[model samples]
Target: MTLFGTTLDAEQIAALLSLLALLVFWLVVLRRERGYARWFKQWEADRKARREAEQAAEKRGASPDGRKGPWG
Candidate 1:
């Protein structure tokens, strides 16, 4: 009953392909962003640790209780 019978619809195939492409693109972008975010968080933590260490060092050389330091 059909002339040159084709079972698939052209519009449906195109739409499916477009959706697949978008899914792949977003996956790649999200993976890269996640890696960068982890790196940034680690960097911030290291910086804070270093600052706290410096402050501790400064305090150690400071006066004991209410007494002045020897170098003061």
Candidate 2:
């Protein structure tokens, strides 16, 4: 309050309130952005697929001795 030896007027107070409202609106829109949601789904799917492949490999008695499994 003493930085410039002056006090804020009514217009300055109103401007601050307007800026706060705009900030909240943009934050909401950013939360609904599709690209962010899509990437999360893609990452989850990839993780699931990898787990399934590993489980299938384990079920076939496949060895890590560089030999192909019977499924091939």
Candidate 3:
């Protein structure tokens, strides 16, 4: 709150404010991810792609990356 020797030094006050800002930043990120925003949507798409790839590899008797597994 005070820049010069006000109970808490400038550095301590700045650190406290910075931590608060970081907390707000994480809260916003969590809200966006939970809301299925574009960023979260990208993750969903990636998961779907992995599922499809695994299914295809299974049919071909291989791993998800197209390499033959031990059973194959």
Candidate 1 — which residues are off by over 4 angstroms?
A: 1-6, 65-72
- Cα-based TM-score, every candidate: 0.66, 0.44, 0.43
Consecutive 10-residue window with the lowest summed lDDT within model 1 = 1-10
Instruction: Report every candidate's CA lDDT.
Output: 0.85, 0.82, 0.83
How does model 3 fare in lDDT? Answer: 0.83
Which ten residues in a row are the worst by lDDT in model 2?
1-10
Q: After superposition, how far is residue 43 of candidate 1 from its true place, in Å?
A: 1.1
Clashes of each: 0, 0, 0
Residue range 1-72, candidate 2, lDDT tens digits? 322777878888788789999999899888778768989999999999999999998867766674785754
Residue 37 miss distance in model 2 (angstroms): 1.1
User: Candidate 1's residue-wise lDDT over 1-72, tens digit each?
Assistant: 222585547776777789999999999999999999999999999999999999999889877774675755
lDDT of 3 by residue, 1-72 (tens): 554656787789889989999999999999878787877789999999999999887788745575564765
Query: In angstroms, how far off is 35's CA in candidate 1?
Result: 1.1
